[model samples]
Target: MPQPTPDRDDQARLFREVVLVLGGVFAVQKTDDETIRRVAAGLERVYRRARQNQRSTTSSQALAPHPAIAGLLRITEAEGDEP
Candidate 1:
């Protein structure tokens, strides 16, 4: 089995690699203004939640953690542009 990578740079690299492998066109696509702003807001919330999660000891490592995964997480959770 492959070892799980935990280093920040390594995780980022892995994330990029995974996205590249899985996302295709949307792996690096851009969206319109309102959609971009909403995504940015959701990302900001995720960052705040990440900070809080660090303080609170959240361990699931998944962005949303819980099954609900929330609207905020839904921003990042979009698999691709196509429905």
Candidate 2:
């Protein structure tokens, strides 16, 4: 049987936790906007590659990266692009 998907509330809570952790890392490391954006872009590339690998190997339902992750990457990339 397929596993049940997380509810929206659970997803939101998880997203918040992820954000908090990332924020703490940034604060602790004093990461600049450019570095953050580069990190995010690198992460996105890795995520996509992993997803492709998983899809090729698995017959089970395909998993997606969270929207919050995608959003964060997009925001960082966009911010880096700005002066």
**Top of the candidates by lDDT:** 2
lDDT of 1 by residue, 1-83 (tens): 85644654564565457445534533356545676567556655655564344554565775545665476467766754448
- C-alpha RMSD of each candidate structure in angstroms: 11.1, 16.0
Q: Model 1 residue 43 lDDT?
A: 57
Please report the TM-score between candidate 2 and the true structure: 0.38
lDDT of each: 0.55, 0.69
* Cα TM-score per model: 0.32, 0.38
Which candidate has the top score in TM-score? 2
lDDT of 2 at 32: 99
Can you write out model 2's per-residue Cα lDDT over 39-58, one digit (the tens) per residue?
Answer: 67765654556434444454
Candidate 2 residues lying further than 4 Å off, grouped into runs, are 1-6, 38-83
